[model samples]
Target: MYSRSNNGARSHRWTATLVMGQVLLWSCAAEAEKLPHNLQIHGFASQSWLMSSDNNVFGKSSSGSGSFDFRELGLNASMRPLPRLQFSAQMLSRWAGKGSEGNIRLDYGFIDYTVFSGETSQFGIRLGRMKNPLGFYNDTRDVPFTRPSILLPQSIYFDRTRKLALAADGVHLYGERRSEMGDISFQAGVARPLVRGDEAEAAVFGQLVQGHLAPEMSYIGRVNYELDGGRIRFAASATQLNMSYSPGEGSIHFVPVIFSAQYNAERWSLTSEYAFRNLQYKNFGAMPDMDISGESYYFQGVYRLTPEWEAIARYDVLYMDSNDRQGRKWAASGTGDGRHAHNRFAKDITVGLRWNITPEFMLRAEYHHVNGTGWLSTLDNPNPADMSQRWDLFSILGSFRF
Candidate 1:
């Protein structure tokens, strides 16, 4: 169990860190004006309102008047004191229903040192907490301007498991080669995955456990190829994640592989990604050991109506267990009550429009027609039986950045 006093102290410390970081950034900026070094500061804030016809998301979206429980605020600073050395850090506070309570925390802080730099190629290493290069959007998922829509395709970027895939504390080695044909880059890291609170626990175990989940050493890597100055792109990423449960000697291991591709044209762009995940559980006293394989994919297209207006359409799908895509075997086994087959799979059709009012401000709205509850948050909708098999979600957001 977690103590309130301890939680409060942690929160205070995190807030203090953010404050101190901001102060340091200002100090660096002042000093940089006197020297040749460079310091850059950037930040963004966004608010969203969501309403659903028959489900809850980021609060009681289905309730009267809808919900305004979704918001994100972030600030970051980067300093280059030497030609081949750089330091960067970001502080973020995000609020999204019960899973995230808008706590201020260090998102990523790292020291990057270039081992070799030349006209056509470079090699470097980064130490400290850094974002995992899982997919194209995972590195910048929190930034609304970088996302294709209000919400990312849930099939690939499961918001419920965001914390788990966000960032890690360790070292990463990166290298890039450029030529007339295109550019090729790769990044690999060995770190400890961040597992906190009950969000990841519930997502993995289907419910919160009495024992705690402890992070273990893990590995992640990605490779990218781009042609025609990013008019076309391809990437492959993979991760081996491990965790342990205390007081009962339980363990978990999962491996996920993702493939991403995109094409950019003058007026339109197309994007797609596919992922395969294999999970294993062992040594739980009451739960039987098991292995599960899952699959997810999405196809998306965006068309620019004008210099400041855009439209998007996408179809996404998620299957929790590929072996039992319909979940007939698991539901028939009677593992628990309200275990419907539809809960194992989800299909979503989405459409949205984006309007850029100014260089630093924007607004967008989107609608989703979804079938199945596979990706719904268990926290917001505690009772599975109460969830509708088919539902609609409408959302609008406004964002500002500098």
Candidate 2:
């Protein structure tokens, strides 16, 4: 006795009610799936304003107030789905203020499989995304709250970036050999190369600006020996770079030699790392500016005066064949013939004090004096021309992290 329209309306209402019920059920199940330890999350809220008499060396302008800006929000979580298998993930979100939507980037996320082989040799394969192991420092390189200095030596690694050697999606093989002197471990992996068309173009001028780990072809291997007394690392790396400008016409060879030594105890710790790299451009123009071979190193001494306070003094240096066909990062910020042979060199001295205000919080203040022509700013400006302007720099910085 019901009309067709009435029948259709009733059917539609039933479908809608069913869909709502399904959504409510899913919401409840999702809430039930979370656990205290399985869903762990932690982050830091920080504020920093650059107080400089001048602008940045890169020619970029700074916000007028020195205005307080949020540096990072970190979230770390891990789960053990099985007795021998575990997964971990970390995210670092940066808020530079203004209209910046902020970047929710994957700091690290991978699955680790433990091998009962008894030597602390865990066979793990990472699928989602992983960090590159070009050198020792690239592993634990992070920002203010964790590092003793405001800036990581640019010669090695820089801050949170989408490119220029960072988290890449691939598989990693890491294992350590145990011995009486200590445990000697090795990490090696093969993946896409670190340089593409633009990356290649930038490297020609000696400014490895950004973008590493693309689908080109790269290999990294590292060996480390750690004992209760100390630790040492020996790393060897090779990368095959392919860029768009050159097409399949040319390639790059990178041979990096790395070394690290660390001694940690109850009150004090000393850590150091050195790297020597040889970069060759193949099938390119016959120019000195096109070929590059360079070396860089850093040494740090830490004194944990107490649980509440720590102090550190560090020095780092880089030596590049300044006279290559074109200039390098130490060269003035500009376009290059890709030619130069000036024996480019840059070195800086830094002294810092860290206050462990509490278990979850820390503060840092440091001073730096650098002598070099390239992007050398003792201050926190990204522009090279703003600070150095073809001269050396004396800069200071202060930042806090949680």
Best by lDDT: 1
Please state the error at residue 185 of candidate 1 in Å: 0.3
lDDT of each: 0.88, 0.52
lDDT of 1 by residue, 221-296 (tens): 9999999999999999999999998987899998999999999999999999999999999999777998999999
Question: Local error of candidate 2 at 187, Å?
Answer: 1.2
Question: Model 1 clash pairs?
Answer: none
| RMSD of each candidate relative to the true structure | 3.4, 12.0
For all predicted structures, in order, the TM-scores are: 0.92, 0.70
Q: How many backbone overlaps does candidate 1 show?
A: 0
